[model samples]
Target: MDTYHKFAAFADLDVERFKHFQEEREALSTLKAVEIDTDADTRLTALTADVKAFKTANDNDIKQLKQQINASTKTYQRLSPFYEQRIALLDQSEAVIVQDDDLYDEITRTKTTQLNADRLDDWRNRTMVLHHQLNKAHEQAKLKEEAERAREKALIRRRVALQQRRQQASLKRQRINETKAYRDRFDNLVVRVRNRVDTLDFKVIDAPIEVINAAEAVAAQAFIFTTLKHTDSFTTLQKSLRDTDAKKIATQVQKAATSLWQQLERLPDNQDKVEVLTKINERFDHVPAITIDGATLTQTVTEHLQKTKNAIQAHEQAQTRRYSSPRPF
Candidate 1:
């Protein structure tokens, strides 16, 4: 009985004050029409700031209502099982209620307010949520400070990168021009060298000595008929002439040197006393050409250049082997 009486007193909390506030709100609404003796200039201004602030707070409160609703929904779901129990319990408690006086009035008022509070809780939560959204909009509207800071940083980076790109482009242009000039000069030198080689000329002359010349013509005729089957013929030719080591040379080179020596050895001059001009012309040609190709190409240039380089290397290697004999022959 004491616990029931305490709950009744709690349920009526702020009832008198809440009533006073409600009555004042009604009076304020009717004041203009009733022509109350209120000063025109001294009229109250609208509470914009207070209303907005309160609305924001209310919206936040309402937005959080889903959790409470979910809880209540769960309770309502479970309420069925407990419904008969609750009704039975309330009946038993109502009998106990008749055993008190002041407790009855307080209990009735408490029940009335408690029911209303329970019903309006969801609405309050919704109001709080709307209030918070309004506050967020207000914050977003006042973004001048952040925008200014971002603009400053962005401009600084833009200028730095622009200057860097300009310098890089200028350096690239300079390098390209320098390379073109170097290539132009090299091309000019090659053209002059080619012109000189194209003008070079040579003529075949009778072997510089009479005896060597006559004997060479006869041996040349003999070589035309020779089948190259003579194994000792090669050895005999090497022994009869100025060549000390003919066997070590390439086949073509050995044949050419042997042919030249065979003609010279059969000359009418002293075979033992070797002459100077006869030895010098052996395995040698006087007129040499500048051997660089002068052809031009657009896209097919690389392959042509590779083939030309390979050919030049082979030609030089042949010259090295032909002239580099360890003997005077």
Candidate 2:
């Protein structure tokens, strides 16, 4: 009867152990059924730590239960049936734990894959944005380079144009200087001719033949120098000088001829006067026959001298007749 009571107590203890194991298994299933937020990394990491701790604790509990069952089997050989039943329960519990472990591993693998895919997508998006920025920078740099080249070209063109303008201005100044020099030289020549013309001494009428010839040469030169040819190209100043010189020369010739004619008229009515008049008439041939007021200067002087000679000859003949005839006194 004591042995029977001891077996019954052992059975009751086995039943309690089995009930505790069942409770542990049901707790494990409950833990698995609770859904974890996959998007939250902190929650998933905490849940995985908790699952690992629970698995370690369950493994310890299972090992302890097995040790107790072995002790009980050694002490109570008569409780073989109970020991066998507990062994089967332990096996079943082990199987369930293994299945839960496999399911947790699969969940871990799926979460890892999802996290890796999210990381790859993020990397690709960043790469695309970086590439776009690089392209934009490259295009902007190209445009800037082109603008710099165009500015350089425009500056070079402006410099060339400025140089050309300077060269043209220099040429124009040189031409103006040359033209001014030519005009100065031409004016000097005209002034020299005028000075030579002014040197003529037309006041001296009874001068020597050499002096008369010198005067006549001077007059001829003045006439030729002052005359304007049709082929001559003259400026306004040169044309004015020529006309003035010509008028002056004509006036001088007229004055000299008139002075000689007046000198002949003042002479006494004698052969000396007639000889002087003939000498004067001969001198007149060498004078320039310049015309003034439609009358030639030398020709008019000759006519006046001829009239004086004729009067002188008539007076001399009257004096000779008076000397040959009886004295009228």
Candidate 3:
């Protein structure tokens, strides 16, 4: 408790009782010196009462100020958690800048003398705004992340489709190339077989009955094989017609060679039979699996023909001599 300064009017007053006359005398004396004419006792009493009222008013003001400071402190305590939570939210967002440190520094450095409800309310409202901004940033970031994920998913699907398309194209190209190669090989085989048939020497035909028939069969086989045309797929053509025709040509040529050898066995040893055999052997040279040694056969046939001619002439002279009369004898 601090004591206030005493009023000058009561400085020399009696301690026991308030003497009105003495106060009046003093006030008058003081007034006379200041050259003022006024009621002494009345003025002194009024002045004293005014001083008392001023002190009372000042005491009331001090008490009301203390009460206001206590109320503000309680309000700040109630709002503190909300303010700190908003600050935490802002820190998490990294998008909102609360600047709480700057505010604290400014207040601390400047020596703020008061804390009030108005300032606390301002802090509360400002924190709410920051919280709202942080929420908006969170929503926007979420939406952006979802959009990016959708874009990535769509890109993956497009890439997969592209890869599948590439694979399909590659497979189609490979099939086309394979088909072309098969066709080329088939055409080449056909051309070769045709040319071989065309060049075959089917000119001479004089031979035994079986030999002639066999030669005719071989000729027919060659004609049919050479004239056969390609059909749908190469595999089908080879399986159904081409392979069959090729086997038939081989069979006929083999049959012809067999028949010719049988006929040669039956025919008498003469130049005519030898010449026919040579021609047959030469024609079959173009056929597969047929070989001929024409030079050796011809040499052998010429010697046999000369020997038979000489034997026939000698027999006819002996018979003529036996049947005629012996004129020379």
Candidate 4:
């Protein structure tokens, strides 16, 4: 009963205010007419012509004003959804309400207004402001990404230079080693990989030198064709040799890496997938070193694998906590 009385009081107050607003609005129209006729000393014919011209201009202005308002409303509606989606993508929950929907809604709510020109212009300007802000934010983000890419490229060049220098010092010594020795090393690395998988832990591991060498052996070993069936064959064992088909081998390795990644993606959330993906991604990070594209591949795979591993670890941690927590009373 108290709730009903309160609602009734609110309704009565709204009715009274609406009646008063109507009376004031009508008075404003009368005031406008009185202003137009205030200069009675002027010639009647000229005054009548002036009033007709004013009405013509007002009608034209109202038509253009309404068109602007409608166009602005449409633009705001179209971009509002995109803005919301972008905010969601960026995970910015707080800024989800950019230019509130209510702003646009208020502009579109009424068909009639005493100050239509002022209201329409204000609404249009508000939408333009929001549009400008979105464009500025997008451009700034693009610039930031470009700058990051430039920095990454510089870092990659340094890494490639360091790798090349290391390879040059070892090239002569490596060439003098017996063919049997190279084959033995390659087989040992493959065995190491099998061992790693058999005793796998779910935690992420660094890209070990043995892992990197094994990946290189997959593409560079002379006996790789005999050792691993259904694998690609390269002409030369030494990657530095001109006869080696580095590009073709790189493509094959890339395909294999992508296949492994797809398998990882399809796996259900489990420790087995995490362990498998960690080894696969380590191989991915170092495999392309026998070719010119190694630096690019390493950088790309490093960023991707780090993010993926971090997310998986976080989920695992969360699950552990959830299961281990004490129950409430």
TM-score, prediction 4: 0.23
Q: Estimate the lDDT of model 3.
A: 0.56
Q: What TM-score against the true fold does each predicted structure earn?
A: 0.20, 0.32, 0.34, 0.23
Model 2: pairs clashing at backbone N, Cα or C within 3 Å: none
lDDT of 2 by residue, 121-227 (tens): 44335445555666688899999999999999999999999999999898777666655654565467556544544454343445445435544544554345344
Instruction: Predict model 4's lDDT versus the native.
Output: 0.52
Which residue pairs in candidate 4 have backbone atoms (N, alpha carbon, C) closer than 3 angstroms, thus clashing? none
Answer with 2 or 3, whichever has the higher lDDT.
3
- Minimum summed lDDT over a 10-residue window in model 4 is located at 221-230
lDDT of 3 by residue, 1-329 (tens): 11112222223432322465456546666665456545555676776775577567657756765676677687668766655544454455333333456544433343223434565456456556766877788899999999999999999999999999999998777667666665566577657655655565434456666756555455445444444433344554344545665566566655654564555567665566656656655655444332223433234334444555565567677778788866675
By TM-score: ranked, best first:
3, 2, 4, 1
- Give the Å shift of residue 145 in candidate 3: 2.9
2 or 4, greater by lDDT: 2
Provide the RMSD of all predictions against the true structure, rounded to 1 decimal: 30.2, 27.2, 15.8, 41.4
Task: Determine which window of 10 residues in candidate 2 has minimal summed lDDT.
Answer: 104-113
What is candidate 4's lDDT per residue for 1-329, written digit by digit as tens? 34346456656755775575556445544544446563433444444565567567657655766676677677667666644443342243224223557754564344332224455456556656766787798899999999999999999999999899889757755665534454565567557654553343322443344443433434333123223433434223533332233344445666644543444455554555455445655544433333223444345445545666677788989999998999999
TM-score of 1: 0.20
Per-residue lDDT over 1-329 for candidate 1, one digit per residue giving the tens place of the 0 to 100 score = 44345445534533653465456556556676547554522332333343456467556655555556666677666654445433443364544443345433434444321433333343334434545665576677657657877888899889888988988888777656655654454356446533432332112333445434332332222222121222233323233321322232223333443454454444333322233223332312221211113321111123333444555577778889988978674
Better of 1 and 3 by lDDT: 3
